[model samples]
Target: MPTPLTPPSAPHWPAPVARTAVDATVALPGSKSMTNRALVLGALASAPVRVVRPLRSRDTDLMADALRALGTGVAEDGSDWLVTPGPLTGPARVDVGLAGTVMRFLPTVAALAAGEVAVDGDPRARERPMGPIITALRELGAEVDDGGRGALPFTVRGRGLVDGGPVTIDASGSSQLVSGLLLAAPRFAKGVEVRHEGPPVPSTPHLAMTVRMLREAGAGVETGENVWRVAPGPLLGGERIIEPDLSNAAQFLGAALVTGGRVTVPGWPDDTVQPGDALRGLLAAMGADVSLGPDGLTVRGSGTFPGVFQGLEADLHEVGELTPVLAALAALAATPSRLTGIAHLRGHETDRLAALVTEINALGGDVRELPDGLEIRPRPLHGGVFHTYDDHRMVMAAAVLGLAVPGVEVENPETVGKTLPDFTGLWTDLVRTA
Candidate 1:
């Protein structure tokens, strides 16, 4: 039997062990990133738009609710959302609820509203970085009252129009700074030109995803060396189908890697700007046989070449979200692995680096936190409570480890609701069938 998932306030939930090699096909939810982006663009369009296979999770739902609060119409049509753009008027309250995308992206949309909007979220949400986007907004001629904190619990005083033009921001903290500005750019009187002047932006794939989606919405976007420009124009509203979340698929495929079995994820997109597309290369480097065909993307493994037999040195700056799963796999690898160029992970849902190091170490594995990444030296892991720190990725990572190592308990297992609410159930079903 699978362990009972605990409530957020519960002490912990024991992670179930897979007694045998896992061999199952798991279908995953729609992409949270794509779903939210589509919602934002749909809300900005002049006519009604349709979003098919939208991820119905905490983050996406929060985005939909926030848009509804801002006078946008988001109604369900079976598995799709029919978004109708309306006059941007608001005396609204937005609860971002620890969703970084909502917190970062919606502020720009809110600035286009005609009234005051107050935005806040979970206590931890207040600690996440927002200054870069906020400062950039103020510089771009929007009135925002952050009370000098530059984070959340701020009020946006919108004047119904933004006098947007060229602006420069330090996006070293996050690529969302540029994306947030660009998403709202097309509505600006002068459009917007954004220049980044700081460390190399982490998660560049996410930035590209933002840009591609904007272009598809009929927005003119020019992206070059560390700069992005969007011309003011009407966003053409139409139907869009969200791709299955490859980031979540990584966890299932990683199960195959660790268990020496095979797992195939259907509906894998041949081309996508999702940062998770990097998984094909990353997993292949770890010695899995990865094949993408008309049927799906299949990852096959056996004991002969299980995980990176030799240690891996990888730069995950563009795909930092995959760090937790990679870190877990590295712990069980035959050789040590060094993952670098992801210092920005320190600013994610939790300080992911610190959380990974602590949780893995607590389970008797050797993982050292680097300033910019992690060094995992393979070690035999036992079982103990793995603290999730309210991060959905941490919950999934711990479940992956539990497949091989018994008695691993996961705290805040409910946190997976943020992105993959049915994570535990899907994992249990797959393991049982295997």
Candidate 2:
């Protein structure tokens, strides 16, 4: 197994403070979600595929390496990735590296291999919920030996095929559970019919992304009220251009709202299944003038600090990934905000809800943790250390707060490399130009 990434000696990074309203155009990297999904589909394609402008972050890299270990050829062609599909063989070791996508999405792909595939990851990856997928994969005729742990550090004894048919799972914990099954279903002997039996699945947009991408690859897919079916067929290989990660754009756009500045992210898709696209509406609700045009998505803040924006009251069930930045903005709002319908965040990189509450309150903010979400009442926030808990989004939240609250030191800021490697650099540029 490969060694886990190590943090630098200096763990605390003092976040940049914005002295003026930030007015800049930030071009972000490709979507990590789309990039990883594309890698999976490309590897499963019948022909060579090219992925254009894919994110080169830790999470996406792990996906590429995992596919390579399964005998797929992933090569870099300039800024693009050329994926050559090969016979899916195993007896390989996969290190998931604390990436939720890797730990959840790759096992089904491994199941299509001919031999044993051992999967493990960072310590936290072992604590994540894997039971639902494990149970569902077994029901679909894959032998997964987790030593009864039902999590990571398991082995999938592949038989070169999976008899995928109807399998039910409680995907309430994560939408990835559903996406993982559907992505590899095209190769299953009987394809797959995934039916969710428990609570409403979080991050529904991500599921839409999976279905759309599958159809784009020429796979037959059908969706119903609470179920999805992918017919066994060939996934076509072709060029796919990934859009900018709008989720990563959250902090930059939130900078506009917090500092009463203007920020725009180019290459914003008019229509996207990425949950980050919801930021347009969410940021607008918080009093930012949002517009999408030839210049991409532009967010103009109404006013700077002391010029209060309205608090937000909404259910972020569909876009739970944007919770941290939105929560940070809520803490800086003029009124109280109630964000609900996101209990599933408890199983994310960390218990995001608890982390947000703890970190925000540590800076002397008033945040109440609810059963499913967070309630933020605007309070006078002071400078203090904001703990990231090794979650990338946590680093983003701290950056947003640092723009308004001085002396906000962030611990383990390097964790942002999970999705955006140049996060600190980009943030400093935006703030410096402010």
Candidate 3:
């Protein structure tokens, strides 16, 4: 085998290995998806809305700043955000950063503003897919200037009212396309009817989340086969509470499964449309005992040393965000694993499928890249420098590997700030307490 990789070229973080089975109660930050959705709906609400326990991270901060740029007031009232609607005027610049939600969701909001709003982001943000949203916007009667490129670094000229009605597009690459339109539909002159006509929309649960949140905010939404209708109406935003980010919770729970330890994530919702909730079944199938109670959800190892659970045969299309952690677990499983239905991951913050394969194989693991997914043959993983590619999920996945493998360094460890600013510190505490 190739020699273990030395430290990376730049600042690297040493991932700590677990000395014992981790037994910690982790309280995660609020959901990024729900926080941004609340921000959008709160901005469009007829009255000031208070979002309780919202996540404060780079992605959510960007969303709040974008709304503030559009003449809304987003102030911190304790851990909540009190969003007061204002005249949607702009001549403002919206820094989308690397946030897919901000980049995809804000343009439609800006279309309802009076002046011009410039939307741009990190260099990688410009390369991400934005054509679907842009095309649908123009069809809905909005003036968007993109300098001939369908991607970001564009400007949306707002006439203060979108003439929304019917539009069709392929939303296979990302679910943000449909969610973005529905979010801005309430402010449109005629509401919106979106028809997704491509490969099954990846992350359908996220779509359901959007629909559920919309209806909860008093908007009329009708869902059909690959179709969604949002009626033009006033959004009644009062006080809304955000659930903990179950996606991020995957990292902590994965730790318990790997160490043959126990972990409880307090405040797990009894009912949620969050895609990460799929972990309950997925982890149980892999031999971890998962239970949901009044306090939250708990996962314990199957009395097997090192928690060598059965390999996974899962389709992670709707929960593609969990692939990195699952891929990491597959690398350490006792049997071979096959994960499918996540080809859409190529369009995420990075080409995740490609990145996972390259980094895992570099660490002395056997992982094959498929056209749509991965086939992992568990093997001994040696310590090495695992590159994160600035993707937050990639960073968390590497940390999971470090639990069993020694001396694994994660490049660009700070990248976890994208979604979970306190990820490293929280992870350290979990390992230390264990």
Candidate 4:
């Protein structure tokens, strides 16, 4: 197993409480989703490429390192990454940490290499769903040795090329399985056609994002009901500027609703496939004034204690990653909330539904775990410790709760380094401005 990134002795951080309405403009880092996808596409390109404003986090760093281990050149220039594609060869070992993207996405890239690539990750990572992708690889004409465990600690004994064709997989667990195959498909001898065969695949926005990036990189792609086709072709190499991670912007925006303050995030794209963009509608449903213009997305809360927001009922299937912060907001809302359509969350960094229910209830809230989602009924809350379970979003959720309920200590706040390395600092500044 890869060395655990979080030490058992990691200190807990006391989530800062907001004393007044916060009015601040927070600038966020680049998207981890985009950064990793860009890196993979760049490494498969016909020439060198530049990924501008890429996220500098553990997950993205692991992606860059994984590509480098497979003989790609990933050099840093200021805040950007310049990738030079080389012959894909490996006798390499990849430590995926706790990053789902690195574990699921890198294996396909490794399948294009000429030698053996051993892939493993942190202890919890071994428990995540990897069977679909592994099975898909074998069906697509690559050799994956999982020893029948169908999980991590696998080896891809690459023959330097995959004879890609139509293959079926049940991507209900995660969309990364589809993206992992699609991102590396352009390099396959015959490209690839992927068809989903089980329950509805979650996170459709992420799937769309993958397709968009592939096309932008010059690969011919087609999509239908439940299938994706990538034509065999050379990917163009050039500069690709990454957008600010709207998903990571969730907590900052949620803070506005919690404190009845105003928070603006700059560079909110006019058009994008990021699921985080759904926050505008979701927050509005819970009673927040939201606007987007040249100044970017701005959210203003009801400037009153307990703010004039009601509980929200929505299906988060396409935007499941937003559940943590949204759940925290639900616990503070004036009415009860029910968030559904995200059963796949059970496979995330932690069993998020259970974790949210347990942590919030520990703080004296009423959150019940549903089979598919959570039903949160607001209750008077008090200060207590909120365990992160090595999940970054869990830390984000705790921070949102602390704005109203004092003494919310988050275990292993450093786990936020998975995506947003400076989350605590940014959150502190936002609260301090209040």
Best by lDDT: 4
For model 4, residues 1-434, the per-residue Cα lDDT tens digits are 12224566777899998888999999999999999999999999999999999999999999999999999999999989999999999899999998988998999999999999999998889999999999999998999999999998999999999999999999999999999999999999999999998899999999999999999999999999999999999999999899999999999999889989899999999999999999999999999999999999999999875466889999999999999999999999999999999899988998888888889999999999898999999999999888888899999999999999889988899889999999999999999988
TM-score for each candidate, following the candidate numbering: 0.96, 0.97, 0.97, 0.98
lDDT of 1 by residue, 160-279 (tens): 999999998889888887888999999999999999998899999999999999999999999899999999999988997899999999889988888778888999998898988898
* Clashes within 3 Å, all models in order: 0, 0, 0, 0
Q: lDDT tens string, model 3, 128-157?
A: 889999999999999999998999999999
TM-score of 2: 0.97
Give lDDT per model, in order.
0.89, 0.92, 0.92, 0.94
Candidate 2 weakest ten by summed lDDT: 1-10
Summed over model 3, clashes come to: 0
Q: Model 4 Cα displacement at 418 (Å)?
A: 0.1
| Candidate with more favorable, higher lDDT: 2 or 4 | 4
Q: Name the better of 2 and 4 by TM-score.
A: 4
User: Higher-lDDT candidate among 1 and 4?
Assistant: 4
Off by over 4 Å in 3: 1-9
- Candidates 3 and 4 compared by TM-score, better number: 4
